[model samples]
Target: MPVVSNPLRALAGALISVLAVSGCQTLDDAGRVIGRADLVNDLAARLDRSTELTYSADYQLPGGRNASISQSQDPLRAAYTYPGGKLTVTADATTACDTSTRKPTCTVTAPQAANAEPSVAIFADMRKRGLVAPPVVVGLLTAAALDPDATIRQYDTTVAGRHATCVEVDQLSDAETAAFDACITGEGALGSFTGTVDGTELEVALSRYRDAVQSGAFDLPAGAGLIDRRADGQPPA
Candidate 1:
């Protein structure tokens, strides 16, 4: 199969690759480990806990009996359509509450959506609620700053009537572009290099500068943006 260029997926894959490289480094940056032991403890604490959430809707039938419909937030839990009677929910490890005594405090707040996924809104809500740890933003920004060879470019384009931010290498050489595409296409070994971090020689995969451009994914967005943003001799919008 041709390598599908999903920027979000690609970014996620890159983040996972960073984690796979060094457990310690991954914890320090991505996992938010104040200490190795603390990190281990946190993971251990979450190992056995379970969480479950279900949204239910009720309807009144011609008879006295009522009908109930429900959906579970648990990813592992399969959805089922049941008779108009009762909906039972059991907590799972992924979505369980933090405490046992109190009612499962897993709260769900639906955000007003206008084009973005509800998950994105939920993430924004979590940020507002101080429920999510801001790690990746710090990590990527830090990587961009500390890493001198970092190349970042902003390409805004419409996709399926929605605007998207396509991040890619700013000024890529032909050879670099080829290598990047090859890496993503699985044609060759993903790029890597050695660098001195804190005086220790560290082998780190070189960020693929060309991967985002390989094939038609890069061109389509570029062309669309050009056409959409073109106002030949007019003031910018």
Candidate 2:
């Protein structure tokens, strides 16, 4: 008996199996190398020990120029994973796109990430309050000599509903001051900030923060208590 082999059929079957495997992966898996479940668990663990907070109502620009706007308060989730257990936070955030012409634009805030916290316990606190991420927590013990201390100051105190922890950097030397100012003002820094985590040496950027703000992306309220002011006279929230 001669066994006939169907090459066409065999190739077709192989293609179907590959497609099935591809569909199993989540967005994070395709975009980045981290696993979806692992990133989620890691984020949840860090947020556990953290607190809850909210943003100050974003004010309209001076010229009546509006940015995209929407509002959301759902618990946060891990959207992407970075190396060393770092993760990007995702949630349904609000946006306000049109203000002057009254055209009313609408869009959900996309995923925003924070610096990685030192311990996994912070995730626990994030979960208790329906939040997906934790705030930046700077340690006092890390302060160095002569580095002008900077504070994790906050505004819109009522919106946060609590006091944010203040961590000052060591006195800033003349050179350091220049660098810090540049970094804060979006001149030569890495990128936009989202938020900070306690016990971590990460500095977020304005782009990340704006993404979170525009989307109402924050899940945990604990980090909301912190504020950063702009030199352009925009009030901190």
Candidate 3:
């Protein structure tokens, strides 16, 4: 899996701090002290089980730009909607792994410039979609779990009038500094996430979650003027 960038790292760091400050001891269901590794593994497990989820968020980017985000996901597909609906991204996992490198790959289609390179379409689409690649939620969680210096502590909390488990991590070290707090519902869905990256803050909350994805939610809209990198093999028309 590709590593998460500084924004995500910072979000993970803030989550960790929040959980730690909640004053709950690091104890799992088995009554053992939840270490850094254990927490990461636990969160990964929960994320894996969450095959479908939907959420909305407000973000404050590095340049102090405020944006609204709506996202939905299932096991094999993910979609995101930005403010004004001007840019939306949906990526589908066409193959589980590359034949030569055995690395995961996907087919991403999005609106593109007439001069954009075919090879760069997917990456550019990801950047336009707030850098959220396929399986956005799980990808973020997985990246945080892979952090070597991450430490997790969990506590009980209430969010949006619902019971949740607040998991926090501390001392996350990647190529840059970061941390985050995540509130997971009892049903194993992310209720909310709060974090800071390089001093910029981001927060997201789940307004709705379901095991089933809406019809056509993952499909490219009619007349979206999208460019398919794998098919066109040329610049946008």
As for lDDT, the candidate ahead, 1 or 3, is 3
TM-score of each: 0.19, 0.21, 0.49
Question: Per-residue lDDT tens digits of candidate 3, residues 1-237?
Answer: 222212222233344443343234433422333353355455545544442345443333334333333445432333444322323432322111111223323333333332332232232332343333223333344445555445666798876556777777677774333577777766555566676543434465655544454565544434344334545453221
lDDT of 1 by residue, 1-237 (tens): 113222122223343344333334433244332232232222222211211222222222222323222333322121111121111211211111112222223222222223332122222322221121112222232243223344444344432233323333322222322111100111111122122222223222222222121122111111121112222332211
Judged by TM-score relative to the true structure, which candidate is superior, 1 or 2? 2
lDDT of each: 0.24, 0.24, 0.43
Best by lDDT: 3
At residue 42, candidate 1 shows an lDDT of 25
Higher-ranked by TM-score: 2 or 3: 3
